[model samples]
Target: MEPFMSDLSALSSALAATAAAAAPSLVSVHSHRSRASGFVWKSDLVVTADEALADEGEVIIAFADGTTRPATIAGRDHTTDVALLRFDGRDVSSTPLARDVPPLGSLAIIVAADQGTPVAALAMVSKSAGPWRSLRGGDIDARIELDTGLRRSSEGSLVLDASGRAVGMAVRGPGRTLVIPAATIERVASKLETHGRIARGYLGAGLQPVKLDEGVGAMVMSLDKNGPAAAAGLRQGDVITALNNAPFSSMRGLMRELGPDSVGAVVDVAALRGGEPMRVALTIGERPA
Candidate 1:
């Protein structure tokens, strides 16, 4: 039997209210710079690039009421892939956290679009939620092992959970799609509102995850203009250990500790370069766009 039209309208309104309550409100990010890369969105505290370090900038924010505000660059957290943007002491609405963020291995739905057409995908968490890559735009984020969320024209968009809560944001593309974890929003909300910046240490170098197939160590990837590794005399085939004398287990760990602020601060780097145990000093620099 056909459903009642009034009942359907009521259901839609109820669902919208529930979603409006559950989903974190989004700040539509717009760029005025001609050379700017793409549009960006902010959920008050969280940005689209909280997955992979290296996203930043100033943006104009659009509120639900048609009011607009210019957002200034606070700082970018490469390790956490979170960029902190700020307005003044003025009040602004943000996407509210509904319930708790999902645990790792839970399911989510990513929605994106090109031009104005909307698209979506279903995915499972690769891990409980660590540093994510929000710059890559593609159908699968290899690092996170999700099935959907890459779009050619969906940068600066929101990724919502099934209940209609925003789980992440859209970013750059071509390969593994990038997104921010909802939990990150929890960590940075307060800072975004107050300071408009997040403090992090810097090291000038390029790095990528390495895998040992058998015994011989090799380089998997490199960074732009020689990354922190290059500046620190780090080379390919180097087995990494600690940053700033802190024991690190993975790339994510290294990033988490790199809350760089000073451009010339010396960071302690421990790695097994060329199979020989070694230590080096890395000079951190302000991140580039």
Candidate 2:
């Protein structure tokens, strides 16, 4: 009984120490009347959940020491649900990110700030899998789900592994808690910092789904005079059946293939022109802002 009690006390103390170490980087993000959690990603940049940030409001960053500062929306990617805030006069250091995904069933700690005070939750890595795409067409590095419930104020909290290395940022998924893996944050946030928005692939043609002999296809209804589709000799009334040998029956399925990672890719487009099958090499263009 004594040994068990001692071990439990040691575990409790270690967890508390982990939370304390992350407290300095944790911050409470307030937009309009809503509040969410965030962490310092750089000296003057903070990362928070895009979904929780109001479209139009004065953003505020509250530190754990009860100090507040005005921040501006540096950039936001709705597909990835990451928003970057820029501020001045504060020198906050970011936590070190874990190089690889934590193993399944490992202990994961969520650290957040509630109005400048640190709060934490302990849970296990419920699911860890290969890369996946979000419903909004963003490519996630890895699918990491936590066995815990995230509070509204903790939407963008930093998720740490047992060793105090940051695994990712927490966000509310459809019905569960999800971690946006560290690798993804490094990739997207850097781009967001340089370009205020992510560039998506563009076809420069209006498409309408049509029933085909075997599967569905998208018929080109209109084309931009200077667009990639027009440059690739894709004419109006052409029905696109497949992209890169992958047949898609819906417009969404086709769009999903044109995520941010496909912005500069060259794809083989299989289409029907006047019932004659033809293939064209098309270099995807960036969607115009």
Candidate 3:
């Protein structure tokens, strides 16, 4: 019984130490009555969850020391749920990110800030898998799910591994808490820093799903004269069945193939033109903001 009690006490102490080490990087993001967590990414940049940020409002970042500063949205990507903010203030050091994904069932510490006060939660890595696509068609580098009850104020908190190294940023997913892995942050945040938005592939045709004899298809209802669909010779009323040899039964399924990585790639389009089968090559273009 004494040994068991000692083990528990050691674990509690270790968790407190880890939380203390990560608290300095955390900040509370406030915008138009919406509050969320964020962390210092670079010298003058902070990263937070995009979904929690309001579209048009003055944003403020409150540090653990109770100091606050006005920040501007440098860049934001809805697909990855990451938003970068640029602020004028003293530089805060960011925690080291783990190069590799943490193993399943490992200890995970969630460090967040609530209105400039530090908060912590302990969880375990419930699921760890390879790269996956979000329902919105964003490509995430790794799939990491945590078994923990995440608070609304901790949406963009820093998720750290047992060694106190950051694994990723914590965000609320469809009824669950998910970690946007470190590799994904590095990829998307860097682009956001440069371009302020992630480019997505666009076909420039308004499509609606329709039931066909064999399966489902997207019928083009409108066309942009100067868009990729027009360049591929696609006209209104053409029912597209497949793209690049993969069949899609819904509009979302087809759009899933047009993620950021799909931009600038040429694809083979399979569609029916006036009851006749036709094939055309289309070069995907960037979607207009």
Judge candidate 2 against the unseen true structure and give its global Cα lDDT, from 0 to 1.
0.91
Put down candidate 2 lDDT per residue, 130-213, tens digits, no spaces: 999887788899999999999999999999999889989999997889999999888888999999888989999999999998
Identify the runs in model 2 with alpha carbons over 4 angstroms from their true place.
273-278
Q: Please state the error at residue 137 of candidate 3 in Å.
A: 1.1
TM values, all candidates? 0.47, 0.90, 0.96
* Residue 100 local lDDT, model 3: 80
TM-score of 3: 0.96
Residue 54 error, candidate 3, Å: 1.2
Better of 1 and 3 by TM-score: 3
All models, RMSD in angstroms: 8.5, 2.1, 1.4
The weakest ten consecutive residues by lDDT in model 1 span 134-143
Cα error, candidate 2, residue 41 (Å): 1.1
For candidate 1, the lDDT comes to 0.49
The superposed Cα distance between candidate 3 and the true structure at residue 187, in angstroms, equals: 0.8
Better of 1 and 2 by lDDT: 2
Of 1 and 2, which scores higher on TM-score?
2
